[model samples]
Target: MIMPNEQKAPLVHLANAIGTMSEVSSRVGQYVLANPEKVVHQTVAELAEYTHSGQASVLRLCRQLGFKGFSEFKLALMAELAASERSTATDSDNEADRYGALLKRLTQSMQKTAYALHAEQLLAIAVHMVKARRISVFGSGISGLVSQLVSYRLMRLGLPAQAFQDPVLAHEVMTDVDKHCVALGISESGVTLDTVEFLKRARTAGAKTIAITGRVNSPVAQAADLVLLAVPIEPLTIGGDISPAISKIYLVELLAMAIADLSHAGRQRNERSKTP
Candidate 1:
């Protein structure tokens, strides 16, 4: 059955992953990029035939791009196509059209990231924060801003939190982290060496580690006891390199809200205990 145009696919995501995939998967990705409409309508076998690749390779490509299979990939393409068609259905260069396209892209970043993250993991992180002696946030570059913002939010909630942007100070502070603390690392790429090192040191010191990153399999994610996936905004999007920050902010805000709820619950318990 044909899916609705409102459904969104991650075409740009596939394109980006292709750059890191093996030759066979890259071939499949390139084929889809070159003929999205045709590939979407065709079966996986047909796509494999057209790309001169095996059906397994096509499936592998879909999974690599975070799809369940070719069917899911096609559905996403259909959604992208639908969005594209709507944007172009009108032929005028009006301000509305320009702004509409911009809004769509920005919302897409949040939707995609939200879909990628699991609620259970987020709740677990909140619980960890509720139980921790302190929460230390670490990031660099644009992620540094995210780290600081999250730290401030935690503090506003009456939690002991700090943001570390400098590698030297991060190392120095991490040296004092103990098992009672929580170490949270934010990295869009998940491979930032300094951030990963901080996480490692924190873990060695027995602190509970959490990683917020776009890459599920990244080193930072691998090192953390808990992983919170955030949708990465493409640099080529409407806002350039700052685009991905939207998704990061979205995930952090959710984390903050969750932590707040946990804190509220704790306060309620304390009040009830006092009454008894």
Candidate 2:
């Protein structure tokens, strides 16, 4: 799908700025705006040839427009095109008639989650996991189940960790947490009072806390030292639906992979240092 020429799309902005760019960059930008369809489908080499500009010029144009690279620029262009198509498409009157729309929404939600995720935060959490002498995961309901999965995965990685759903037992465990402990709380709504209390208690006990929730402003988020958000979707959901649980699992898997990678890298570095 191609965006309307009248719209103020990302490419339009680049085209608008053509007057302000260097001569070579201006050539690349002008070619992109003039051949927007080609820009979408063509590789950097192909696009450069079409624009009669060097690859460096094309890359410079992307950088000048604040994109990290050509691939990111293309992705942004595609997103804008998708938005345009959605805006122009006729709506389905009923939910059942909009199955494709629902799927699209779910896909977009995951994409938005990826965009919202902060790499530095994940790295910081991984570092904390490596340093912590013990890890305790806490939650209730669906989130509690996800917490248990997280604990299981961490233990499988040879990390000392456990999960608790009982608020009383979880709190009692928090009392043993100290500077060397990492307490993780998983709550979709972020308003789970028991989870919040457990995090608060753990933090007060001098342990570092992490919150995995949908709402950043919730009590649980405020109590934790680090927050990792999972996508929340409850519209038109049936009772006891586990749609949001899928997102929670996705986030936990990401954390587990990061922790494993960091641990593996550390071990390899240690082995290298011990080499004769």
Candidate 3:
């Protein structure tokens, strides 16, 4: 049975971890919500004292959020603030300025994401994909696109790969998946009913399953054999809806490249064995 706190634990742990060292770190989130304008300019000590916490706690909070230190966290917080400002700006801004602002926001998000990706976790995923006899990927909507990209990269490396965007097809495939097969599911929200059901079915059928999603505490993550989490942040808005998709694609591309490199090495090893 799933525990009630299971869904909330990651965020709660994040808060508690920082709070343990400094009371200010726990309060920073509340402070930012109440005083959005000050978020961009508040120093660590100021934020700590304001929350009746210590500077050490503030730094610990930043680390828990996957930043190198307080300065990096401050930059990310400031970037989010700037994006929020651009979204709410009333004055007419030029098209070029808007585009530039959006670009900056996306770049910042991508940088943070790159920093959070664990090399060991990536290598483990690649190894699993390389060893599996067949691979199936599933997702819906935007995440379906990511699934397709994963399938495409695996196929290019000469592996048997397939992606199902349709729920019916995904369910059909899951029924026959075996121990030699692997299933990869991508979902940012981690609560997509269709995707979760398909993954559950795949696992029941004895296939190894992996999940790539934003929330570590999500049910989808709990159901998979392996879970890779993308740290969550506020949705980025540019002049339109394009930037968020582009930013997500950048991270997906990195995942694909890592798998491809590992698959290629596996193929080389197989060729040498056949020759001997």
Poorly placed runs, candidate 1 (over 4 Å) = 1-96, 234-240
TM-score of each: 0.69, 0.65, 0.64
- lDDT per model vs. reference: 0.77, 0.75, 0.65
Ranking by TM-score: 1, 2, 3
lDDT of 2: 0.75
lDDT of 2 by residue, 87-197 (tens): 434334466646655565455445444544566788899889889999999989888889989999889988899999999999888778899999999998788999999
Worst-scoring 10-residue span by lDDT in model 2: 1-10
| Candidate 3 Cα outliers beyond 4 Å, as residue runs | 1-92, 231-242, 267-276
Q: Which one wins on lDDT?
A: 1
| lDDT score of residue 211 within candidate 3 | 85
Q: How accurate is candidate 1 locally (lDDT)?
A: 0.77
Candidate ranking (lDDT, best to worst): 1, 2, 3
TM-score of 3: 0.64
Question: Which scores better on lDDT, 2 or 3?
Answer: 2
What does candidate 1's lDDT look like per residue over 1-276, in tens digits?
123342355676764455456767765664565356667689988988876789999888877766677788788888787776666555227878866666666676676566555567799989888788988999998889889988988898888999999999999998888989999999877889998999999999999999988765568877899976665542234423666677788888898889888878888999999994
Give the candidate number with the greatest TM-score.
1
The count of residue-pair clashes in candidate 3 stands at 1
